[model samples]
Target: MKKSIKISLGGLAFNIEEDAYAILEEYIESLIMHLGNTPEAKDIVGDIEARASELFIDLLSGMQTITIDMVSSVIEILGRPEQIVNGGESNGQSDKKSEEPKSTERRRLYRDGENGIIAGVASGLGIYFNIDSIVFRILFGVLLFANGLGAIVYIVMWIAVPIAVTTRQRMEMRGENINFSNLEKNVKEEFNKVKQNMEKRNVSGFFQKFFNTVGQILIAIGRVFGVIAKVIVVILAVVFISIGLIGLLATTASIFFGSTIVSLFPTFSGVTLAELIGSTFDLGSTLWIVIPLFFVLAIPLLALVFLGLRMVFRFKMRDTVVFVSVATIWIIAVTLLAFVLFFQARSFTIRETVRDKTELILESAQTSTIRLVANANILEGVDIPQKFFNLDDYSIANNNGKPMIMGKPSFFIGKSTSDSFELLILKRSRGATSQLARRSANGLSLLFELQDNSLVVDPFFTLSQGDKWRAQDVEVTLLLPEGKRVYIDRSMEPILSANQTCCMSWPDELVGRIWEMRGNKLVEIR
Candidate 1:
């Protein structure tokens, strides 16, 4: 049985057979003798020993102790001291020999830790391209200040590039041919530089320390700003996502469910919100408008959310095609919506008004009590599913599976110059031309009846079948003779124009109060 001995190689502990340890020691002694007792020699020897130790570790993966065979194999791979010395001379000769074509050496990008500030990306790039690292650093700094793209590129390079840790890696970083001679030269140069720096370290210690402290402070400030920026981005991302989602959901709901939800609120104008939007574009064209609108809003929001995640997690998604596609789609959507709105606006260029008067024959009485009430109760008995669109004025109902438009009629009361009571109906609408406007105005169906002194008017009117909304509206004015007592009902408040009411609260406070038309105004009877 062979005796096992403990040995240290390149700052690492190892168990080796007695014979293996002796062989390794002899090889190291021979290297030292050949290299001499210089600092450069020590660096080369150290690198060699470290390489050998790495090989030994790999060879003895399952074994408890390294054998002589493992040591011999490692030494053979490292080559003899004479070979290394002769190789340097041969490399010099080969450089002088122009006839001998040199093979192209593969270079790897690595951060040059020896000559770098922050990360060593610029230093590594400088070494790779045989340029001064300071130049690259200055350029990057300029780019960072100029357009902010330099920072992003620098960060990406820092994360992507590897650091040159080994002597061979350091040589490769400089685009040098990887061989024993070049590796030894690189190690020797690095040691000489290190020694020169050590000699001046005492003289520059204070300045170096001061600069290091400043660098640390700058790095700390950068980190704080980075964190703050991330927080802001995340908050913006959340907001964008919330808005996009809500808008998409609302738009989708409206499209699928029709104008049922919008119909709940009463509009001051006779036109419903859905009808107004629908007027700009037909239901088919609206699909194009809403779809594009949704994409335009939602895509950017989603992109913001993704960007936030990428920034926080340090992930890269190099999807230029997807970005371009989304941008193109958004542009298209915007263009289409603009085009539709442009034409829709022209439809309301002209306005037309049509008026008709019907004289009321009242039964002869001392004082006729004319009660104004809305005729909404007429549809209550009709077998149809009625949806109140605008308060009680407008509603939508299915008549034999066809959609019908309903509108509310507003009223204004004034004293007549004539002795008899007269009802005047004024229908107004907007269109692209005067003729179209007149046709739109004439399409409004407003019905009212006079039963003795009780005048019943429909609260809402309906447009002709298949007629698109052109802001159609109706105005009812009751021309009452002087001294005719008129009673207003509470139900007519929605359709009653408050401006014509002379500051009196319509229907609510004015209901049950008897008012006589005195000239142009209706004065309350005491």
Candidate 2:
């Protein structure tokens, strides 16, 4: 049996037969002696060793150890030490003499990190297809104006393509054969290009210097903008994360704690949080509304935070995984929200209105006046705090252990067909069916009373207990005789009708103003 030994090549461990190891060592020593002890020589040797290790591993496949035959094959492919030393001149002469076709190796797609602007995709594509990188960059920029499709495509390509890091990878990207001669030629070409650029800059005249200065200024400006962009992203991440966390916590508490905490806080519309949610959705459908709600808000915020971290720290992540996960979650959340809203809208399809009229008899008196005022006793009895929650449009209160909905009441003045004074109350509500709508409309508990010459009207109307709010509203019409006069109170401003056109802009400004009914309009009397 041949003696086997452990060897490390290009930082990779391998098991090789003693004879194979000796051959490989001798081949590498000859390359070192021919190339001389320079940094370039060291790099060349490392690349050759790495390439050889790759080839050996490929050839051994299922073998337990590398043999001398494998090592000899790898060295032959790399070429002799004398050939490598004079390959640049001899290969060119030999190709011309033999009239042989050039290598037809296929090019590979890889991100050219050495000559890239962003993620190296454009540069890599340029090298692979034998085109200018600026053309691809400009094309991508133009596509960005076509509804941002270019940006999406670029991100996908950046994530999918691998970066050309090793010398072999770079050679493959340029369709060059992975051999020592091509590698040396490529390295020398890069070194010469850099040297020429430096020499040109050193010899640059006035215009060249001016252009270089302008380029430097632009680069500085770009760096400043990059910093600003990172700052903006960080700020947005903080704001989004804060809002998402708060919304998620609130939703969780409402779901587990049964809205007990939510009820304690009053909404901007003077409605309890529980009352507003209960009005819009049923308890059974709350999950569909709440769960997707969290993902819709939270996922984007989490993604923003991740992006901000990447920008600030210049760290890399599994971008494909993060992007796909976030996109999927956002789509599902939006779909669920749409579905819940669509079904909930069906609850307000039909409207029904209920009307009640009552006649008032007054003793014969000259200059009879009707004063409109709000009933404070009823509001006090309901135990509703007088503190306004900017809810002039609607309000909710607890009445005898039941939920009550209140809405603004509007009034209109009209001439009586008969000589008697009448008051009409119209209550309106909506439901899935007309019957249900009518029942809901008839369930209101609004009150109005006429004491002496003063007419006390509730500024707001209330719905019955356990009724979901379906855009409930009330309108009060006062049918007055031609000779009767009326006075409006300032407290009733919230419930004033919007159809008035008596040169008065504000309803509250018309308070304490006396008006007499003529044919159809109420004419102001000084």
Candidate 3:
């Protein structure tokens, strides 16, 4: 047994054994010597000693006396000078002033040691906000409704806030200075909790069975959702790949016949057969002849990639770095081959480009309403903002189910003065590749007639984007007045989220295209 000392470190100090004191001094001196007898020794020495002191206390608590080896381990953790000197930025006043504040008086946000789930995030929040932690959790949980949004928010908070451990930190928790010892205590408590949990897992019978059952249930739910997500992703990928492959097949078929004929053609010079073959060799046909063969040869190689991807998924190839490297190389090679094809394909004549100019056959044959077909696949790659829309309030005009008024470009509509105006491609916020073609076609169904001497969109018209029926076109046979028998139905999402263009127009155009759902009084395309 050794006597405790009342030596002060910076400002905070507690008793220590005489032998412990000697060892601490020797360890600090060795650290100073390593840093050299320079002017910056004061700064370096103080940091190393303070860190060493904390380490020493930690070592002593864990069933052994503090040793020089423990101090060296602490030094190793602190590291040395780097591109930016880490610890020398602060001084005596900065640190001492921090310690001067009484514990409870200093305000702080910390992970709570008591009344916490993982760390003390909720407990600390409850303490700071003057509300019960349970209440905050319940509120966010209710808002998220088990959609995992609360979990995301909780995780973000955990990563952001540090746990309060020092006595000063406890005071800071009560609103005080950060206590180093308190901080360490919180950390120790956390590690202990983990240890306890591991012990629980290790124990046999009763509580173990109960916990295992709960864990299994959670894992099952996670797996189910994971499987559903994976399936959807695979389906979407297959659809996209199918589209690409169809193009590849068409390209291959064209070349196959061409190559066969080109190879089998009788090369009889100065003869009737030669003359006939020469006559058939037009520039367009000759080019088409070579292209199909190129596609056929290239198409089979794509299978290698599909096989690689399947192998990666099935065997957990991602667990090994070598597998990842090989997969990456495969991808690069495939990409380069694609580039070559694209270059080779440039010389091939294309009939599709001839028809690239939009064939707009717009006429008001019917008078009820028109339909717009928006090609939303072109807009899928973009990440839409959560709250970029100006949608605030809405009233379902003819929806069949409870309408959702939040997220994305919200729609708002109002009672028509005359009648629901003819649906038209008013204005699109964003899209690519035949952006307004669908809208122009679908929203212009002259199926709407002059109701009360005004052109209106036909009822029951569904405007779909990427196979999602975002809005339906209803024929305006009767006046859709406020509080009328309007039906709003949510089309169960059977595909990836639809990125239909922001269909906002006829705002204040009392008799033009009407979108009352987006809160537009009357939006008209200028």
> Against the correct fold, how does model 1 do in TM-score?
0.57
**lDDT by residue (tens digit), candidate 3, 339-407:** 644644432322111111111222542333323222233213322322111222211111121111111
Clashing pairs in 2: none
Better of 1 and 2 by TM-score: 2
Could you tell me the lDDT of residue 393 within candidate 3? 22
TM agreement with the true structure for every prediction: 0.57, 0.64, 0.23
The best-first sequence of candidates by TM-score reads: 2, 1, 3
The segments of candidate 1 whose C-alpha lies over 4 angstroms from its true place after superposition are 1-192, 199-218, 249-253, 256-314, 376-401, 501-509
Superposed Cα deviation of residue 296, candidate 2 (Å): 2.7
Superior candidate under TM-score, 1 versus 3: 1
Clashes of each: 0, 0, 86
- By lDDT, highest first, what's the ranking? 2, 1, 3
Q: Write the per-residue lDDT of candidate 1 for residues 1-526, one digit (tens) a residue.
A: 9999898897777889999889889988988887777756766777677767777777976577889899888887776778755644556655635532253455678988777776778999888887899999999999999999898888767655777987777866766544334556677777788889988765646666675676556556677877898788777766756675676576565544455553453232223334445543545645656666667666676676666566456553336677888888888888887887787778789999999998887675564668888776757633344333333455655444344667777788877778888899999988989998899899999888877777889877878877767777889888889778788887777777865744355555666677788766788888
C-alpha-based local distance difference test score of model 3: 0.41
Q: How many backbone clashes does candidate 3 have?
A: 86
Between candidates 2 and 3, the one scoring higher on TM-score is 2
Candidate 2, superposed: residue stretches over 4 Å from native = 1-37, 41-181, 188-274, 283-285, 319-322, 362-367, 381-392, 398-403, 501-506
